[model samples]
Target: MNSPQLAIVLGTRPEIVKLAPIIRECRDRDVPHIVVHTGQHYSPQLTEVFFDELELPPPDHALGVGSATHGEQTGSMIAGIEEVLLEADPETVLVQGDTNTTLAATIAASKLDAELGHVEAGLRSDDRGMPEEVNRIICDHTADRLFAPTPAAAENLRAEGVPSDRISVTGNTVVDALQRHRGLAADRTAVLDDLGVEPGEYGLLTLHRAENVDDPDRFADLLTGVGRVAREYEMDVVYPAHPRARKKLEDLRVPNAVEVVEPLDYLEFLRLESDASVILTDSGGVQEEACVLGVPCVTLRENTERPETIAAGANRLGGVTPTGIFETAREMVGTDAEWENPFGDGDAAARILDAAAATDADGADDSAAATEAVQ
Candidate 1:
């Protein structure tokens, strides 16, 4: 009998990091699968270093659809992915998270005759203003299988009228990736030593969201708050600058007191994230990682999609203002990092792949059923 074929699509470092275990699961189970890179994360370190470090196979199809305006990026990815779907004709197409890549892949696969499974599904910020909010909403409604990280996420799906049978509160794949990689990072990485910092004595900052960095005044305010955190705490703060933020930071010529470094690879970054005293960021993925690693997190946004982190007592809302950011950092950074990880056990990839493979055992005819359900 032929092995079941699955098309796994992703485009960013976070997607690749979370999806590594799933891809590894597919390989171990003798399941035929392909990785489709959307190229939204275009840099070599952002894309290739992850696969290399994780020892996962390189993408079978790279759409080469790098960043552009939102409409242009999504439209290009949709076109590129549709061409792959038409040619590969896999039984299932799996996408994760709420990037443009995820949305476009959902649209492409939904239009094709393939079963769609969305990992890290059903999360909502409730504020439609965030672009990511828009993507995940459409994805949850369109997904045939919604793998939600928390019960809250599943409940949100249900509240939106998603059938309960289709929703599974599978823990977040972030946990899976972290568990599998954290030990390796600790053993192999000298990120702390290289950066000349002691573990649990410094703050780590990652700011790359458009709403924060693209605006000059807001960016200045964020840096001001971060500098304040460093001065007040008398602690070393490191910022691993994203490529998008680099130009903006330079253009603004904003001199932050924090140490700015090049972005580290998965293992190094994971090491840095785990050892930090606190993590301040505008990233959703980093918040989850910080919570799982028992690091205090001060979100630079007014609201978050992962309210579980806040409710679990791991995260604090540090709104965009300098005062909000400074106060929240001071409040959160020195507190006990005692929140239980609300994402999931380290076995989410196993469950996700099992669900994908079960579709194969059941038969290929379910594609039509899946299509009807998703549509």
Candidate 2:
């Protein structure tokens, strides 16, 4: 019924999870905001369930721009998001993480009158081979507001010559969302029981990145590596297969110790993450979640955007080889899980809103609005 003052654009499960706190903040503040889902991740299990689990309002707009080539997906989402921006005519448009949806929303909002804010800004893996890295760089350069999750991220923005005025170290919303929902996840989900796994006994594995799964040789080596870790540690691993990765599983000799399961909902996955002995993943969000959850993590990549996890001693880069994965898993499994969280306290959502509200619709400073916004 109200003309939305903010437009939150997202498209993947990680986006939904990371942005949930902001949506809740908006509701609590009575800030009229509309959610636009670009359908980059369209599966109901991955997408719709998050809205329900997070108690978020259904998306105001869903652009069914399903699977396509990188260019096609980004192009389609830009057109769809532009249409939503035109109609909603919000004062600010916010997008989270590095995805086609983020890039599209950034490009769309850049051309419009709305100020564009990028959540999880200035994360660089320094791997130009990854499409996500490209998207992150483009979105950061184009955004009016850069919400860096950590001081390191803020420094990266500064090094890139991003104006200090346009940047804010608002922490990572994943911490906010995780702190709020992990208790609910523990209480509401019996995923551990359903999977016949006990707390701190089973390993959690997730591999969806194109670099890891798209190559047959690399995928096979990763599975073999997990198998080595499982056998060495005497633990069974639950691999919640992403749709893209699942397709490549056919005819591949999956390790007997690694049980491939369908993708779990947010609550289920969170429960698993909270209780697992070690988490092996390529997802940046999972890296943050693992760090926040105090779970030892072994990244299945050579480099990561979330290097804070590594510097915190909560995570180790395992690369994509059997020897590397096994060694990292062995090293991480012995960790105490007491590493300090490098992300931030669970108030990022509030700070981000504060920053956004501090600026007027025309992008001018308004100290009174900032104070009122936090009040």
Candidate 3:
């Protein structure tokens, strides 16, 4: 049996959804790649549910390294990912986004002679306080090949002193995933019907980021504000609660006007998101998807790594303040979604594969060297 040349490492639902196009591209080209599940999400519903919906193959390796402190989680991932890399010895390991799994897998692969490719590289909110910002900075530095989502992102790498030769402007893969699965979502998903809402008649809400949900007062403010907007606008607000956020519920029925639901799989969620009149979310991916789908998005974060979304007028920043959230949602409900998408033309996966292959063709892995130079 020959060892695969590429290993795609992923954990959590967002990573799976974002990486689906790359995984499918590998299959389409008959490329030798292994899928390794890091189990950073811990729940089957949040991990495997996506693979099932996307028709992805089961992972070649599964590391059930569940939740832990940042250090513990990342450390656990490094040990487990090291075991897999040692056995597989792929020429390159591809990780997406800025989850602990991505950082851990990239670092562990670095310890070996394996090269690293980051799918969503050079994204920065510039806030070191955000764990994801830290993860992306490290991953971008360590990656031998950096697939940036936009020109702005590539410029960020250049600003950080990453070599121009290694960075490829691959559009956000979420657009690819949306294009591929949205029809399936619309055709198959009954979530809108199940929720008793008409297309463009309601707002979709997804708030799970630690910054928003961690503080009791802030979280309460967000919900209260959203509820006020929902009531005033006479629109239903459907929230698919993240498991972590669900656990911190001070009042299940708080703002009883809003409907909190179990998280939907990717397809169903996409269906809901696409036709939504307005979108309120803290997830960066959601912001990109809303932009691509021409839905007005009110990001509930002070800053976003995906600034192109806001610059294009498809999105607006609505901080954690109740007033900010309510006013942004109210004003943004009238926002036009016809702006040109700055992410890409939905060919990011192909460009990523081409860049990655070209990178490895040069023979020597430059990951460690690049990291050293950047640092």
Candidate 4:
């Protein structure tokens, strides 16, 4: 019998990070898999560095669809992915998380009548303001297999009318990547020495959402709040700055106290998260990473899809207001150890693969049934 072929699709940094473990699993199992990059975040600094650090293989196909209007980007990816699906003819197409890549690929594969599997399915922020919410809803609805990261996510799927049988509570794959790279983290204290700081002596910060950085006032509020906390706590703050965040910081004349360095690779970021006294961020994956590493998180957004972290006391929503930010940081810095990790252990990638294999088995049975019906 021939081994099944799988096409794993990813375009952005978070997608690459979350999908790497599963790609490794496919290689170890001798499964024929091809990786496709949509070029949603094509940057030598961001995408290339992560691929190098994670040792991800060069993508077999690159759509080269760089930044554009959301509609334009999604349309381009869908058309490109449809062509790849026709050419590759893989038995299944795998997508991770709620990005334009995920929604576009899901639409392309479903239109091609291929089985779709969604990792990190069923996340909801209940805020229609987020483009990601639309992507999440569309992908979950179309997926033949939904690999939810938590039971709460599974419940969200159930509430949204997804078939219960299609949803499986696999843990989050970010935890798998974190566990895999944490061994290297122990050897990475030089990042601290380079910054002239010690472990637990500072807060780690990251903010790069259009809503936050595009608004000059909101951006300044976040910067000022972080600087105030650093001063109040007598702590240093490191921001492995996103490109947009860095540009905004410069344009707004952000204060001197907040150190804005280039974004760190996965291992370095994980080490920073592990050692930081607290983490402040507007990124979803970082929120989950903080939870997995048992670091206190202050979300710099008005809402979040990962409310489980907040519920578990591992995180709080601080939005972009200076008062909100300072209060949340003070509370977190004072009570960092009080929170428990709401995300799961490191078995998420394995469980997700197991679910996909099971889905394949069931698909085979269904095909057999159709042939019998014809007979």
Q: What's model 3's lDDT at 10? A: 94
Pairs clashing within candidate 1: none
Order by TM-score, highest first: 2, 3, 1, 4
Question: Each model's RMSD to truth, in Å?
Answer: 4.7, 3.3, 4.4, 5.8
Q: State in Å the error of residue 29, model 3.
A: 0.9
Top candidate on lDDT is 2
Which candidate gets the maximum TM-score versus the true structure? 2
Q: What TM-score would each prediction reach against the true structure?
A: 0.93, 0.95, 0.94, 0.92
Candidate 2, clashing residue pairs?
Answer: none
lDDT tens digits by residue: candidate 3, 295-329:
99999989999899888899989988889989888
Candidate 3: stretches off by over 4 Å: 359-375
Error at 283, model 1, angstroms: 0.5
Model 2: per-residue Cα lDDT over 226-309, one tens digit each: 999999989999999988899999969999999999999999999999999999998898999999899999999999999999
How would the candidate models be sorted by lDDT, starting from the highest? 2, 3, 1, 4
lDDT of 3 at 202: 87
- The superposed Cα distance between candidate 2 and the true structure at residue 190, in angstroms, equals 1.2
Clashing pairs in 4: none
